[model samples]
Target chain A: MERTTFNALDPNSNVGCGRGSGVEQGAEETIFTEQASDDHVIIKDSCDVTVTTTDIQAAVNLQVAIQLAIALVLSVSIADGSQAQKIQQDLLQRISTKQLIRQKTYIENSRGIEVTMTDAEASVSIQLLLQVLLALVAKLDVL
Target chain B: MNESDQLANKLGELLLGDVLERNGFTPSSKRPLTPEQKQQIRTVLENLQVETERFLQHSQRTIRRESKPNH
Candidate 1:
């Protein structure tokens, strides 16, 4: 949709003009071009001028799309920071409460003068004591 | 009797038998532990319990400390 005008007299201009392309030599020529559909264009005149045009609408759209994507990413990251912090705090509080309860129970059981052990607790304790005694017996025999 | 009491009674018998056998005394099936032996066994089990609890507490503390943010 963008239009570009090239002056044939400018040596730096990319417009190409051959001597047989109907452009008069030594006279400044103005060429109006629409959006270029291909990568290469050959314009010829008597002055042997050369020119090129690029699609501006596509480039502008690409820039705008990139900026919008960056803004969206920035906003999401900002929102997630506080949300992640809150979730971590909540999980830590729950774990702390459970640990406190377990510690209290453990202390109470350990401190009792005549502690009564559950079946599973008694089994584990007996197994541990057997292992210790067996190790002692083995050591005493070795000596 | 609770499971721990039964376990303790069984362990006491086993220990008494072992000690007697080591001292060249005949082991008896019905022999009960002396008051002194019972006290010693209780002390050992209590010490083991305390050590286990301390170790667990230390592990939990280490985990909690490491789980926290450094900053």
Candidate 2:
């Protein structure tokens, strides 16, 4: 049987070939040996490689962040759809409820003259109508 | 938010104070809208009314389309 055995004599060398346990921290050493007989070896190989867990984790985190950003943008566009129309309708309804359709009472005075009296609930209703209209215009202008 | 939206927010706040004061309520500030501001607001509202009508019509059409059954 023909046998070949090689041993790496350098342990602290960074030249990609080494033996012993000083090949750098977190490095994995793989050894392969082929034996033709009980005392004869045909081929042998050894390698030391460092595995960077931080780099792999960072790459995974970046991929997750990208997916989250894409999902956020899609959700925002869908949620904002028809938002302007709803805002306009809400402003209009505010005016109608606050000012136009408020209840009032007509009371006869001591001289038999009828007096139109607005309820306390409707006191400030029509006064804020202009402000609501202004806001509605501003919203529609943006749209 | 964009510049226009920021401006609209500030203008709305100012209008709120003005309306409160004019309606016999005490406001946070005493700054009422000037006559020019009032006129500008009125003009904008007039223009927006036409657009609002068109928008409502378009929205109604969209609603009808979405409610229809697919063949």
Q: Give the top-scoring candidate (TM-score).
A: 2
CAPRI verdict on model 2? incorrect
The worst-scoring run of ten residues by lDDT in candidate 1 chain A lies at: A103-112
Compose the digit string of candidate 1's lDDT tens values, residues A42-120.
2332233222122223223332332332222222322344432443233223212111101111111000011121223
DockQ for candidate 2, C-alpha atoms: 0.03
Give the alpha carbon lDDT tens digit for every residue of A82-123 in model 2. 432333343334334322222222111011111222222222
RMSD of each: 36.5, 33.5
lDDT of 1 by residue, B4-71 (tens): 54665566445534543443432121134456644554464455445434432332110100011112
Model 2 accuracy (lDDT, Cα): 0.32
Show where candidate 2 strays beyond 4 Å. Answer: A1-81, A93-95, A98-116, A119-123, A138-143, B1-71
In candidate 2, list every pair of residues with a backbone clash. none
Task: Evaluate model 1 with DockQ and give the value.
Answer: 0.01
What TM-score does chain A of each model score against the native chain A? Answer: 0.25, 0.25
Q: Rate the local accuracy (lDDT) of all candidates.
A: 0.32, 0.32
